[model samples]
Target: MRKLIVTEFISVDGIAEVERLPGVTWNDEMQRFKEDELADSGAMLLGRTTYEIFAGSWPKETGDFADRFNALPKYVASTSLKALDWKPAELLKAHCRKRSGN
Candidate 1:
């Protein structure tokens, strides 16, 4: 069985949506942690917002983080997206449910 680990970033006030938070950046420790975590994961599961954010930016960026992010297989849960053009990406239908322990 495979383990499903959900990783997220939230503000100190418990706000999960931080796309507009200014001066917010991942420190060295956080970067290292993220790199290590991604290294261990074979696939990435993302919501539509996050998937779009990454899909728009990571493709044009160059670095270890970008390389790892673009290289990993991604499964995105979205109801409105017509297509996922990001290479190695799959679009999950609205009725689909993410499962673990398979």
Candidate 2:
């Protein structure tokens, strides 16, 4: 079975928003970390908002990270989204539940 790994960033106050916090900025170390994590991942599972955000930006980006991210299969969990325009992307299904007969 394929392993599922989840990565999330949350502030100490429990804010899950993606917006940069006050006095914070993106750094080379963070970029390297993300690159390494993406390199280790075979596929990406994203929620609707994240999927939309990524689809809007990553496709326009160019580089190793963008290349790998665009090439990887993207599975989005969204019931409201009617279609996905990104290449190698599809709506996620409840495969785990189906497999376990839950």
Candidate 3:
């Protein structure tokens, strides 16, 4: 079976928010960490909201990260999403299930 890794962005106080936290610095260590994580992931599994955010922004972005993100196969698990225009996308109809804490 393929390893299903679910990476998430959360606050220290336990809030699920996708935004740059205040006072958090971006450094080489963080970049290397992210690179390592993504290196192991063959594709991206995203929810509707995250998919919408990435699909809208990553296509216009440029750089190694953007290139990698845009090129990876995206598996969007959603019930209401009817269409996906992004390349290499697969819609997992009604396959989205919430995790324990999500």
TM-scores, one per candidate: 0.82, 0.79, 0.80
TM-score for candidate 3, please give it.
Answer: 0.80
Q: Judged by lDDT against the true structure, how good is candidate 2? A: 0.82
- Clash count of each predicted structure: 0, 0, 0
lDDT of 3: 0.83
Residue 49, model 2: Cα distance from true site in angstroms: 1.1
Q: What is each predicted model's overall lDDT from 0 to 1?
A: 0.82, 0.82, 0.83
lDDT of 3 by residue, 1-102 (tens): 789987776767878755664456779988897888888889998878999988888899999887887899999989889999887999998676656865
lDDT of 2 by residue, 1-101 (tens): 88998887777787777565334677999888998898889999888899988898889999887898899999988767778888798887443222355
Model 3, residue pairs in steric clash: none
lDDT of 1 by residue, 13-100 (tens): 8887656544678599987898888888999888888898888877998988788779989988887788997779888877566577
Q: Candidate 1 local accuracy as lDDT?
A: 0.82
Minimal lDDT window, size 10, model 3: 16-25
Most accurate candidate by lDDT: 3
